[model samples]
Target: MRIAVFIKKTTFHKGYGGIETQNKSLCEGLTKRGHEVFVFSPKLELDRNSIVENGVRYIFVSCAFKMDGFFGERNKDNWFTRSAQRFEEEHAKQPFDVVIGQSSAAVGVIKRKWELNIKVVSVAHGTIISEYKTFLNNMVGLREWIKIVSNTGYVLKSFFSRQREYVHGSEKVVAVSNFVKSALVDETFVDAQKVEVIHNGVDGGARPIQAHPNNQPLKLVYIGRLERSKGLQNLLKAISRLNNVTLSVIGDGPYLPQLARLVKSLHLSERLIFVGRVAPEKIPEILSQANVFVYPSLRYEGFPMAVVEAMFCGLPVIASNIGGISDALENGTTGYLVKSGIIADLRDTIREFVNKPDLIRKMGDAAYAKAQREFNLDTMLSKYEKILEDVVK
Candidate 1:
């Protein structure tokens, strides 16, 4: 079947975060299954606007922030009106069998379905509505207050409009987890039957390397965007409480500078290595070197891709017991899940792991087994293809 998958931006390993990685994986996975896949993303770089890889084709539409401008203020240009015009003009020569839009707010599929009379599917990655509300609620100060007042209605309207589209536009909503689907159903008032929970898969092609946690140096790794919601600060504080455990912070975001300052203030410069923005391809190697994989995300996450990757690499995950995280990792079985946002809980969890170093390998092996059983890329890809077929029929 011919499929048109829409995402906000397209990037390779070195480019950006989870959304891009997942889109790329899905495109490749679909192509591997002998399906004609076309990726529609905004052209971030000035160089090549279009590229075809393997059996998958990519068309990059012009947007404000290039690739990095996903949530930037300049994303208004990629709306349903503009994207629909571009998509129609580009595909006028050829049509697609199905249309799937990632990042549910990319309402271009809403226009695409209406114009082309095709099945459009919108995949909700996280609690976008709640996140927007949190963003609005966090706005403070005098001049900033003015900006919030002027644009508050617009954000609120856009949030509600996207919720409506996700509910009505697509054949059904593709949620990364039951947690995300529940959030959408409860918050957006979408019918529960209209949403399907498909967990994110890990690219297990990377060979797993064994690195025993020797008494020399215990390594802790966090691989994802270093945002405030990711609870990096809490991880840093926990690190400060412990001794001889060096943390290699992977990935980068707006919270880096503040986090760096915090690290300096806490005198954890030697203990913490902030290796900003490592590629997802190189993550398994990094995970192999570490004794523990820590993802202390405090916010409402859909399902963390990096954590699954870590588990696939046979690293015991130390993550917050929130959202779909608990669903993924069995508490005290595969990995330890601490209470979200509690410094004491995280600190204690870290200490527990530190005291019982041998338990790391046992939990890591269990996590690896779980990954092979449930979180393998092939299994996830098959499930997604079946869902698409079900939706299209």
Candidate 2:
């Protein structure tokens, strides 16, 4: 099958976000399965119009500005529309079987589906309103306030409305979790029957699980963006209350400065270590050194890839019991799932693991086993292929 994947950005060129990782994984996975895959994205680090690597083709769409800016400001040149035109021109000879779009790009492809005449699948990673609310929850100082005000029109006009159109316009909608599917149907008014829950998968072979070390000052790792919505502030607060545990933060984002200030305020400079952004190859190495994986996200995440990656590394997770996180973590089985944003609950949960170190190994083992059985990359690829094939038929 010939598949066209549309995403605003990808890890292939630059950035190390979950969406980019998933997009790359899916494209590579499908290509390996003998399907011809073409990924369309805005200009990337690679200075080329098109390139084929690992049997998957990548087409970079040149835009006026990067997709990481304010919504209204970034959409001025109709980047997605221009991208769709470029894709059509490139594939005019042999049409694609189906076009799979992620988030905002999905809306663009769906709007042009008439010209493309292909099955369009919109994969909802998360809702715009939910993301905005999370950002609003973490607002501090004049900079954040100005950002919110500047993006408000764009959020309402483009971001939010595009999500609605993407859900309603696409031939099929892929929700990363039941939580996301519920949001699409209940909040966005997408047809319940059209939405399918497909959880993200991780490369099982990417990392080797290390044996838990019997070391003092238990090592705790959090491996996502250092954003306010990620609940790192809550984690820092929780860590301040405990003496036996130290933290290793393994990503970078806009909220890093605020988090650093919060850490200083709490006087947890010695307890927490910010490792910044590391290559994907080094994630397992970082996770292997830790006894516990903490992801105290305050927002409704679609499905956190870091949690599953940590599980694959044989580390028990302590994340919020919100959205798809609950789907991945079985409280008391894989690890503990505390109430979102409650510092005391998170602190107590950490203390529980600190006191009962034995449960750490036991739960880590369970998490590893679950990741192998359910969240393997091959299993996820198979499901995705089936969905694309079925949609095409």
Candidate 3:
């Protein structure tokens, strides 16, 4: 099958995000299965217009405006839509069996469905409405507040207009989690029948279980963008209350300075270590060195890839009990889930693991087992393949 994947930007162009990771994973997976997968993205510093890597082909489209920034909101000239049209025209001889569009890319694909003459599947990672609300609630200052307020209009317009077309306009909709599926159907009025829940998967079976010595300090790791909604501040607050535990933050974002200030004010400079933006390949090694994985996100997540990656690396997770996180972890089995924003509860959960260090190894074993059984990469790829094939038929 010839598949065209439309994403605003990808890891190919130094775009780092869960959506980009998923897009790359899906494309590579399909390519491995002997399907010809073509990924379309805005032009970047590529050596050529197109490049084939890991059995998949990447096509870079040159547009008048660069659709950079989060959610590609900086694209005031509809660069993605224009790029899609150009891709269609350039590849006019070869028709795609199906076009898989991720989030914002879906809007452009839906707009050109008639011209492309292909089945379109819009993959919804999360809802814009929920994200807008999260940003509004987490606004730090007047600048952030004004920015969110301005973007709120676009989000509202997308929710009422483009979002509906993106959801209803596609042949089928792929929701990364049950939480995402519910949000699409309940919030956007997308047909529940058209929405399919497919949890994101990760490559497993790499590292063997490493022992966490009882005499050593409790090693806690949080791997994600250091944003306000990620609850890193809440994690810092909870950790400050604890005694012997140490946290290794393995990502970078705008909120790093604020978090650093909070650490200083709380006098937790010694307990916290920020290893900003480690390469993806080095994550397992980093996770192997830790005993517990903490993801204290306050917002609704569409199946956090970091949590699953941690689970795959044989570390038990202590994440907030919200969104798709609940689906990823079975409380008391794989790991514990604390109530969002409840500092006492989070602190207590950390203490539970700290006091009973043996439970950490036990939960880590269970987490690895769960990750192998449920979140295997091949399983996710096969499901996606079937969906794409079925959609086209």
Candidate 4:
């Protein structure tokens, strides 16, 4: 099968994130299954407009436009128009069987469905409704306010204009989690029957780490963009009460300095180490190095690949009880979930790991087993392949 994948940005241009990682894995996986895959993104890392890596083609688009009004109008503009124009240029060479769009990335193509004579499948990260309700949970200050104002405009457009295409113009819609499916169905009023829940998966074989040493301090890791809304400072506060636990913070972002100040204030400078951006291959090693994974996010997340990757490495997780974390982590079995933004709850959860220590091994083993059986990359790829084939038929 020949396929066209549309996303606003990509791992080649943007750094690794859950959506970017999923798209990258899906494209490569489809190609491995003897399918032709072409990816369209707003920009790429290389100087050329296009590059082929992992047997998939990446086309960089440089187009932009505005909707008729701020709140309404389903067609064209944004990254959608420019990428669709490029796709048309490529389709002349060899037509594609279908297009897999990420969020609003393929809005233009969906708008021109009859004209293009193609089927579109939208992959929604999360609904605009969830973002609106949880905006304050993860945001603050002037810059965040500006960001929300921009997001608010998109939310209005999503509701008034583009939501129609999302519902009626696509062959199907894939939500990254059951939680996301609920938001799309209940909050966005999308037809629940039309939305399929395909939980996000990480690309890694389940690998359990060796036993922890009794002499060393218990190791904990937090991997993701260091945003204030991620509650890294709060994580620091939660861990301050315990001296036996040390944290390894992986990733870099605008909130680094603020997090650093908190580390210093709490005198956790020695116990907590910031290991900024490492190669993707290094992730397994980092996960193995830690006894547990911490996801202290206070924002609305779809499904965090970090948590999945951690589980893949056989590390139990302690995360905020929101988004898909609750679904991913089988509380007290595979891992534990704490009330979002509750420092006491988070601290208490960590204390359980510190005091018992043996729970890590038991839960970590369960976590690894769960990851291999439920949401590994292979399962996700197979589901996507089956859906594409069904839609094309």
How good is model 4 by TM-score? 0.94
The TM-score leader among the candidates is 4
Candidate 3 lDDT, 251-297, residue by residue in tens = 88888999999999999888889999887889899989898999999
Rank order (by TM-score, best first): 4, 3, 2, 1
Worst 10 residues of 1 by lDDT: 65-74
Quote the positional error of residue 54 for candidate 3 in Å: 1.4
Residue 390 Cα positional deviation in candidate 3, in Å, after optimal superposition: 0.7
Clashes of each: 1, 0, 0, 0
Error of 2 at 21 (Å): 0.6
Every candidate's lDDT: 0.77, 0.83, 0.84, 0.83
Per residue, candidate 4 scores C-alpha lDDT tens digits across 82-153 of 676788888878889999998877877887877887898889887777777677666677887878777777
For each of the candidates, the C-alpha root-mean-square deviation to the true structure, in angstroms, is 3.5, 2.7, 2.7, 2.3
Q: Would you list the clashing residue pairs of candidate 3?
A: none
The alpha-carbon deviation from the true structure for residue 70 of candidate 3, after best TM-score superposition, in angstroms, is 18
Whichever of 2 and 4 has more TM-score, that candidate is 4
The regions of model 4 sitting more than 4 angstroms off are: 44-46, 65-78, 142-149
Question: Using Cα atoms with residue i matched to residue i, what is each candidate's TM-score against the true structure?
Answer: 0.89, 0.92, 0.93, 0.94
Where does candidate 2 have its weakest 10-residue lDDT segment?
A: 205-214
TM-score of 1: 0.89
TM-score of predicted model 2? 0.92
- Candidate 3 backbone clash number: 0
